[model samples]
Target: MRIGILGAGRMADALGTQWARAGHELMVSGRAPEKAAALAERIGPAARVGTFREAATFGDAVLLAIRDDGVQDVLAAAGAADGTLQGRVLVDCTNPVVPEKLTLKTAGGPSMAERVAAATRAHVVKAFNLCHEDVWRMTPPVFDGVKLAVPLCGDDPDALALVRTLVTGLGCEPIDGGALERAALLEATAAFMIGLWFSGANAQAVIPPLKYAFGAH
Candidate 1:
């Protein structure tokens, strides 16, 4: 799979590293190409760095990993939700955590994923928001031993499948998180999770470390 990521921050590095190790081709882009290059080099030989336009053009799927406030800007700059992003599955990992408010920027109305979907018309899926960088960095290597559950949401079946495959490649179980509209819940949960980390618990400690639960069928 060819994955194009808009942000070259910790989230991209964490997941991109595992994707590359899993033999998926990756191209990372940011406001600066250098930052993308540096991260890509660390990922593996298959990963490359490019401009936002090029990244969008090169990838079969797009992962938006920019900051909460910067989501709109990066999407506009990267041509997401526009002519370029047509028919692409956009896996949004944004949390919308306002620095001043310390909560979500989209509190009153629809969620961030809704805004992006309305703007782009592409398939939007909420995923990877609940995870911390350390979780992906330290855990994916020992998948069978750890079996982490990763949740994702989108309207498109195919897009959801792709995200599931990507999550599995990262050594995590992909729980279907319902529709794109339900993305607000995920973002809010992420915000609460961040606050929990500040409550003296280790980041991964909050993540349960379970793959999936069995039912009493």
Candidate 2:
């Protein structure tokens, strides 16, 4: 599979490098040519550098790994609003939250993932947003003998399948998180968990085990 990454930041580097190592062809692009080139070089021979538009056009699946505020501009530059991304699988790993406040930037409106879907008319999937980029950098991201579970929210089955494969490539499990409409929940969860993490709390411990979720029988 061919993957295109639309940012040269840590998220882009971590996910792109993992996918490249998994034998997927990758195109790394960014607003800065040097950054993109450097990232591509770091990813080794399985990856190459390209312009945003070129990268958008090059992949079967495109990862929109840019900052939330820059998403619109970058998508526009990639001709997404002009149909460059139509019918493609677009992965959204962005969290539209104000870190200090732990509040969503799109509080009363659509999720960042929804906005990306609207802007590009692509099969958008909300994923890889809950954890820090460093977590993604882990070779398999397992803990306590369990593979990390990645929740995915998307409307299209085929697109979700592709993303599930990508998730598995990193040795993680893919969790079906309902449809695109549920993405707002995931984004809000990110804000909530991030706040917990910032406060030195174990966010994962707050959730009950599956057997006790609805009370022990």
* Stretches of model 2 off by over 4 angstroms after superposition: none
**Residue-wise C-alpha lDDT for candidate 2, range 48-150, written one tens digit per residue:** 9999999998978999998899999999999997899999999999999897799999989989999999999999999999999999999999999989999
Residue-pair clashes per candidate: 1, 0
Candidate 2 lDDT: 0.95
**Residue 179 in candidate 2 has what lDDT?**
96
Q: What is the C-alpha lDDT profile of model 1 across 59-151, one tens digit per residue?
A: 779888888778777878878645677788888888888754558889888999988888777788889888677788864545447577778
Off by over 4 Å in 1: 141-146, 201-217
Q: How far is candidate 1 from the true structure (C-alpha RMSD, Å)?
A: 3.5
Candidate 2 pairs with clashing backbones: none
TM-score of 1: 0.87
Measured against the true structure, the TM-scores of the candidates, in listed sequence, are 0.87, 0.98
| Total colliding residue pairs, candidate 2 | 0
Model 1 weakest lDDT span, ten residues long: 208-217
